[model samples]
Target: MSKSRIFLFLMLCFIGGVALRSLVFIGSFYLWFLFGVLTIAVFSFSRNRTALLYAALIAVTIAGALWYGRFVPEHLALERFVGQEAAREGSIVKDPEFKNTTQRLVVSFPEAPSERVLVVARRYPEFGYGDIVRVSGTLEKPEPFDGFNYSAYLAKDSVYFTVSFANVALVKEGSGFARGLFALKRKFEENINAALSSPQSAFANGVLLGDTSGISKELNDAFIATGMSHITALSGYNITVMLIFTHLLLAQLLLPRTVVFWASVGIVAAFVVMTGASPSVVRAALMGLALLLARHLGREGSVLHILVFAACAMIVVNPRILAFDVGFQLSFLAVLGLAYIAPWLEAKLKRIPEAFKLKESFVATVSAQAAVLPLLLYQFHQVSLIAPLTNVLVLPLMPFVMLFGFAVGALGFVSYHAALAVAYPLWLALSYQLGVIHYFSQFSYAQIAF
Candidate 1:
């Protein structure tokens, strides 16, 4: 076999071995062992010194990855923070204190009273962006529910404690590195809130900016039922949309290649800030950035390889993330399905009419469904029979809906009348689509529960 083919085969074997090891165990050590063995094998088989050097580099990389994974915060430490007294001097690391009937703040302690520290403060604090306060609340570890581990969720995010409302108070303004990120995040939230008025607009903002606070539970349920819930989060679809928009805009401007590259980077960075820089969003942004770099360098990069690299990087940063985070898994697998299976299906279905090339949409939905089906069944215990049809019907209109919805929302922020004129048509279309989803969901056998 050719060297490239051999290399590809080794890579595939390494990935499969890693995946199998992950399922059989709980952490990255086994995967690291597999990686080391594969690296040695690759080096031993290759005749060229350059190839051997590359293999050795890969081995070192995997070794570092394994060490990093081993160093993340312990699960037991996270579990121990439950019902502990809240530290007074804590700073908000995430978005601002948005008030509902109850307010939630995700904060980190600068100097921990205890080594295990992270808290979700649930109280009304005078805390705005960059606010540092002396909270007086007790820390309670999150309780898991319905087979879902809430503690694990917080742990993945590096949160180990939760404070009840009565326990937290504002001390002073927070300073240092994270303050700027939170400031930008707060502004992005304000922009999204100001720009989006209607429910559809709110949903659009959630998809584009990861501001799902405005989306109603009813609408959220409909999205989940119809298998379109990913539309409401900053996922691979949003990343793809941003990349396409950047490429088209740059292409029209006759910009230099370097300038376009930086522009793409800027857009992704802006998007990361706008989306709260969640794990999934960051992963998508990095993957998109890698693809952009490949384009700029005029080298063809495999999406699958880029995806593997991104996943490995994230896992190395926090191995527990793979076990605890559903969003991470869904986002990664969804993108993988689109990157690999969707293209193959599209190629096979290319003979169909261009208008009917809902083939790509169909492939994407099916691919994502295939990846997440077991999880869905395990979590929700129901499978939609109409998902494929629903996706095809709704997919064609998504780009138009997203574009016009954003435009109308932007206009609405400036002028109510003008915004309403643009919004009315967009809402009409979305409402009709929602109606179809609802109608399909109501069918006798629309879904089957295990």
Candidate 2:
């Protein structure tokens, strides 16, 4: 078999194993028995290269299952503490996620360092990442609701239990690289709020940093109704847009492709860090970098392979994400659509105007939306009827929105007045975008819930 095919086949087997183990429990004994069977089959098929390859695939699949099983014990360990009232000390592992009047913190206990417990605390008396806090509350496992497997979703991050209304006391303030990153993010958020009003500032923060904590429920629903929430999710779509915009703008200055590539890489890396390197953003940034490398090598045809390789690489690191992380799944599907489905869409869209590359952008938007539509329906059970039109209208402006948003945010670090000066144009762009979203969302059939 060709090397590329061999690589793809093996990856698919591994992914299959992970997915299987995620959906169905496979005990260690059964896994080992299957491995031994595959071993014998491998020896039996040694006379035929193709047969040997098939046997090797089965072995890799079993290995993948075993890999996932290795983490099952960690999850089980966390489950044991559920329904118990305990006082535990651990550091806040990530920045607090605020929603309405409460903030959610992922706390890692020293006794069970491998697992995470979600702490729901009041928005007041805020806590930052890496703070050692003593939490006293009843531990509870996340329960599935409304057909959503909340437990599986949290499992993607190794979080199995939750502590609601916890009495959390700060034992020590966090000081480290992660704490610094969170502090920097907070400063940028403050600057954004200082420069713009409520919804606009919230929108800027959402699109720029994937921080939607400030976006009100009404405006957020409008975004959802218009199928524009992905713009704020910091998925591959946003990162890809930033990379392409940077590459093209820099290319216009007649810079070397190599210089443009590295410069773009630097910008993306900084953006990822500025966004606090959340898993979704990190995943998207990695894919963006892979795309840049592929383009630099003039190997665009190999992008699908690169995409699969990137995904499998991530899956290898955290196997549960394959089956549990909705963000990761949607991001992968979006890119897959762009690579495999966008070309056909672009070719068929010849009648559309090419000015400002409208046709190309439309093709990209539609292809990506199409790729993720099924998952959206399955997960959300709601369909945005006007999604295509709204996306085509809004996507063309995202590059500008992101560019100006970043400029204003960076200026805020220097002077609030200086940032405000630039915020006017951003405010105009955001108003126009928001207007489109809310206006379209008012249609009688804008979206339909199943």
Candidate 3:
């Protein structure tokens, strides 16, 4: 096999090993033993090239299993502290997520810096990222409820403990690059709010910065029913659009391709940081970066290869994410659909009007929704029957919505009046999107439940 083929095979084997562990528990000793056996088999088969390749691939697979096995113990380490009421000092690692009257904070203690605890507190006592807080509450592991593996979901982030209605006190205000980034993010959010009204401003923030904290439950439910919630949560689709927009806009300035690529990468990196670099965004960014690298190198990189490389790179860092993070799963599947299914769909979708890129958007929406259908049903217990229609209506406007929203938010920092001028187009875009969501969501058959 060619070098690229060999590399792809090994990567796939490694991912299989990691997924195998996720589905079936294999002890460390067994994994290590398998690794040793594979090593011996490789040596024994050294005289036979084919046998050696097979042995090597098996070894790589075992390595993946071992990689995943290493983290299993750390996942269980926090269980000991469950059921105890304790006050622990920790820094808020992520921006607090506010929903209605409650704010959820992911705090990491110095004692166990790698592990995190989700603290649920009142929305009034706002805590920013990196704030050192003392939390007092009964520590509990998240239970799998409503057919959701909530524990596994949290486990993907090393968040193994939960503290409900916690007595949280800020011991010290945060300071550092992360804190500064968050402060900037908060300022942007304030600017957005000042420029636009509730729900619309909230939607703007969601698309522009992946800040869904301001989105209302009713609007949120509408998005969910319409299968448009991914717009609010940054995903591969948004990143792809942003990257393309950046490249084209920068290209118009007559910059060299190298300069444009690097500048786009920098902007995306900044966007990722501003969005707190959640795993899903990071995954999407990695893939986007990979594509940029391929284009820069003048190589026609395979999309499947790029996708696999990005995923394996992430799984190597945090194996649990492969199985536990729903966002990662959705992002991967969506892109996988774009890479493989979308082209087939495009060919079959001939005769769909190409005006306004409707044909392109329709193919993408159908492919992605189809790819993620099984996972959605398994995870959420419902399917958006109107997903393709709603996505087709909204996807085309997303780039404009994001651009205008971002422009208004950034302009708000300089002048409220200046921001309002930009906000008009953004308002119109959001109104249309919200209208589509509301109009489609009202249908009884918009979504179907098991």
Candidate 4:
């Protein structure tokens, strides 16, 4: 690629990403701003026809996609039923019944009087994945909380209502697409859960498999206090872990390149299923796939390019995702921070020990924090002042914890005693790390309110 083409590509990618994220906070004007930037760049760099053409194509595509997304029917309508009663029949699209006292269900209606509605049901019947049920209840829109906006949350998932069900009855069973996806998600959860046990393990499973059912509020608070909460969610860490593990596994096998490629693809597929295939997980999986493919093709992969393609594909299919998706924004911003800012900082920190060489890891953590800080502050109104230090100390141990935990879990199935042998060491290491986090968190100034 020509230098000008590369520059234009970078510009388009940057602007497009910012635009998509801005949709959640500032709305469509971000899309307009992106267009304006592209228009100016195209004119300013008119000397390079190829560069200009590429920039224009990207600008138009993004702008068009945003425009089209606005008109698509909302997934669930909460407005009409506020303080009103409605009896609706829907199938639970997700695993309904879980170990948690509270559960989330994505219900789909056979035929809604209006568009389908997403309900956050509370204190209802025991339901599992693929359960078809009719709910008679009142639906209402969720109001915004403190600094966080609820409408965007609903919009991202295309959910429009929260329902308090007076009664839910099991109807016909779910089939085809719903059943298949649910079963796959359940199996993945089972594997991860069976592999690890404990509050920390529960948190890891959430981070790796999107199963937060087992995590308690106290553990969640501990994570937040230590700034390690991201480790409990499906984000870049899980994707990178999956990539490293897959590369290692594939390398050990003497398969042909084509066969290896397919095998790698299969691993990602399995990982996606194992992780509940949340929007963020799916996004990371796509990016991981792109990185793998770029390596296969011998192209110098740009994180920006991979991110843009993934965002475009996701938005095209579900435009509402841009508006109501916290995971989408967090995933995009965290990766963007690593891509754009982490390298510059790493270059500056080159004199550090090779093991700690990339103070860029710290920079990556800080950059991701910066990108999401506003949202975090807006939502929680408190910041962990010691997050940087805590992350630096704790992050190094994550891969070990995940690897050992995964191995222990996998082996436990064959020999319980063997798994315990592995778990003992892993648990000791985790305990020490947890102690460090707790110790630091107790410092007088560990956290500061915004």
Candidate 5:
């Protein structure tokens, strides 16, 4: 590896070390710094000592900053109300997410030693983004459940305590960019419903924009049975597929590669933002945009750099995601599979014709599945024995579904009838994909439970 790549590698090591330490304990960040210092000391005799030392020091600083930003708030917040419940007022920091019969919102307290609380509200009477409300509820701290640290999951976003079924009054309505984005997202969901009927509409909402709110339990189970749950869970693969498709189509328009690359980046970023910039979406956007910039600069060898750097950056920004976020884990691993394993498998699939996206889809599916399989088994004990086949059959149709879904929403913004026209083919592809999932799910061995 080049010096830059070496630097990237060691930097990632530091960040990964910090992230792993955070997963197991708190207030041990200095250990990571010491480890980095030791690593640099070991490299002191190398010809590239100075350059590598700077790299190590930079990584140490990032690791320290990320750990501090991640835990200091939680420490202070826990000190404030470690044992008792008290009335507190905070601004609703995030849009209310209504999932599986519960409404979740992050509220930021205004008082000293401010902390963010993940408020689990009653199913009804939804709250909006930026809503300032006085809340009185038992502050329950999150803890690990079933090998997944629910606490770390919330802490990834700087949330320490949770308010359950709290007595919340909307002292003020939400405002600003996030609020508008939330409203727009709700409108898009409404448009999805208007464009397609139930089940299909809900599934499309999930696939195209990561909204599985309206999907029924049975249907969700079917998706998992077919090993297609990644689509519903906002896998970065979905976003990557859309970006590739958009780029491919626009490349034929005779647009300059520069324009096409940046346009694709913009489109991917816009979609990520519209989908609330979930960890997976942001990761995918970063990776996709990095690839675009790579192609633009004629430096394709930097893909590993891009992937590692992106993962480290995300960890620095939110280290909790390193272990706690399943999507984050699967997304990075899947991309790694694509980057390394897929190329090696080309000879194995050389006989399969690459037409109609058959070859590409199969290779990508197998690569990602192989990379993510162990983690899947560890994190979610169930596995779809036929996931490779299911993905091959369904993933190729995703781009069409996504594009048509977007068109339906954009047109629905104007007229329902216009949106309906696009919905015909959109629904057709979605139904076909759903039919594939449904059929595969019928087999007794399609998926196995632990």
Candidate 6:
């Protein structure tokens, strides 16, 4: 109990249990009260005031998380929609996700909305963040599909109901920082489109901004067949690579390492915002920042503590994620694997080729696959057989593609000629990438579906 990590481990177990209990509506005020008393009575026998303080804060957080998940207003439930036809007025609270066939937006009531609803509409007359609108349609709850709990999946984001394409009337446009963030994202996407074409622009957008909606099913399926889809989603691995590239790029500009380090954190923060701030990216960014802080303090041994602390904080912030969000699970496990297992794998593979960092890239792909394979199989039901080969071929070029793509997109804001010039080399890299994916996808052995 004297160990600093003892409290941390206990907190993790407590939070995990509480979040699990929340899923089935198992939490009540009585459970919270009894748990509080038991915790206090146990701590009463100890003299560790610091531990007491930590435990108290943790207890409160778990209590809140339990309450939020299990006890909300009745209107927030899916039962609120008594019939199929209904009309509701709310504001678009999240950025709309535009795909080839549909546009999905999350709308919430203007007056103290306790929950958000997913609005699926046609891919026309687009809506951005923070637009007041009147929606008319039949409300339907997502159903389980292919053994997947689609309802629980949407519940993780507090989305309880969905409305298909209906008449959507805009009441007003958005303002403030949320609006500005989406606006900037739209501009950046336009720039990428201006510089590249079809699958090239699609690949470059995915590399630079995690914009995969533009990618055709053929190209996307190709990446999936090759086990390269993770790169396009901008998962934790991609975010980690982006952060490291930003740090190196800043350092090369003659900035002090400390300044460059913090700036990189800021840049990653901005990137997360631009990419819709999924739990995986946010978790990776926070953990990366925590490590940066530990290094800045000149004590690397504290990294483990910082990692645990950051995970706990994120879990407490969104307790539902612990149980429902696959992104959170994959993100944390991926980093955990890299931190604890990649070194051993890297050493074992050192006898392998180092050309274009092929050995390291292959090992990284293997280590991450080892860590997340079980979850991926359960969730996605497909495993890529050619993942190692494809990773070795493509990973070494990732940093460069992302850098040049960002440059070309940014330069478009200032100079079109410069953007076009940069696009040529960017095009070459993307063409090679597209070629590799297309070639691998043709092999029936590339992936196995369960």
Q: Identify the candidate with maximal TM-score.
A: 2
Model 4, residue pairs in steric clash: 76-117, 97-127, 152-324, 156-324, 195-409
lDDT per residue for candidate 4 within 382-449, as digits (tens), equals 77888877877776555556656655655654677777678777777677667777788677776777
- Every model's TM-score: 0.72, 0.94, 0.90, 0.75, 0.86, 0.85
Q: Tell me, what's the RMSD of every candidate?
A: 5.5, 2.1, 2.7, 5.5, 3.6, 3.8
| lDDT, candidate 2, 217-263, per-residue tens | 88988988987777777677767666666666777689988999899
lDDT (CA) per prediction: 0.60, 0.83, 0.79, 0.62, 0.74, 0.72
Worst 10 residues of 1 by lDDT: 14-23
State the lDDT of candidate 6 residue by residue for 1-450, as single tens digits: 557766566666666655656565654665678677859765785687766766665665556556455533455544657357877889988778889878898999754476778898888888889898888888787888888788777877778777877678788888888688778778878888998887799888776666688888888889889988777765565555455545655766898878887788777776667555645567767765765566667766666677677777876676667777776676666665555566688787677766654454455545655676677667767888887788768776676677678778778889988999998998998999889889989998889988
Q: Write the per-residue lDDT of candidate 1 for residues 1-450, one digit (tens) a residue.
A: 456555554454444433433334446756567686877788677888767656755665455445544545444443455566645566666655343345566766655523333434454544654567666666676788876677767766666667665456677776655566556565544544554446755666666666676777777777666766656656655565445345545666889888888987886676576445755678767765665665577655456555666666676666655656666666666666555665578788788865532444455556555555566556666677777678667655554565455555445436766766776677776776677766776666766666
Candidate 5 structure quality by residue, lDDT tens digits, 1-450: 477966676767666566656644544456566656767765774567666666666656556545644544534645557556677878887667788778888888876435678888776677888888888888877777777778767766778888787777778776788778778778877887988998789988988777778888878888888877877767656665566667767787899988898888877766776666655567766765665565578776777777777777777776667767787777777777766787789778787776755466556656666777788777767878988788778876776777678778767778999999999999888889888988888898888878
Model 3, which residues run further than 4 Å from truth? 74-78, 248-256, 341-374
- How large an RMSD does model 4 have? 5.5
> Per lDDT, what order, best first?
2, 3, 5, 6, 4, 1
Let me know the TM-score candidate 6 reaches against the reference structure. 0.85
Listed per model in order, the count of residue pairs whose N, CA or C atoms clash below 3 Å is: 13, 0, 0, 5, 0, 0
How far out, in Å, is residue 435 in model 6? 1.5
Model 1: what TM-score?
0.72
Clashing pairs in 2: none
lDDT of 3 by residue, 1-450 (tens): 899889999999999999999979888888888878777877786899999888878888888998998777544566788899989999999877877788999999877888889999999889898899999999998898877788878878778889999999999998888778777778878888898887798888888767787887788899889877777666666675556556656787999998999998988887776556666778877766765676567664466677788889999999998998776787778666656786688888786766655465556656666676677667767789988788778876765676577677677778999999998888888888899999998888888777
What is the C-alpha local distance difference test score of candidate 2?
0.83
Error (Å) of candidate 6 at residue 177 is: 2.0
Q: Cα deviation of 97 in candidate 2 (Å)?
A: 0.7
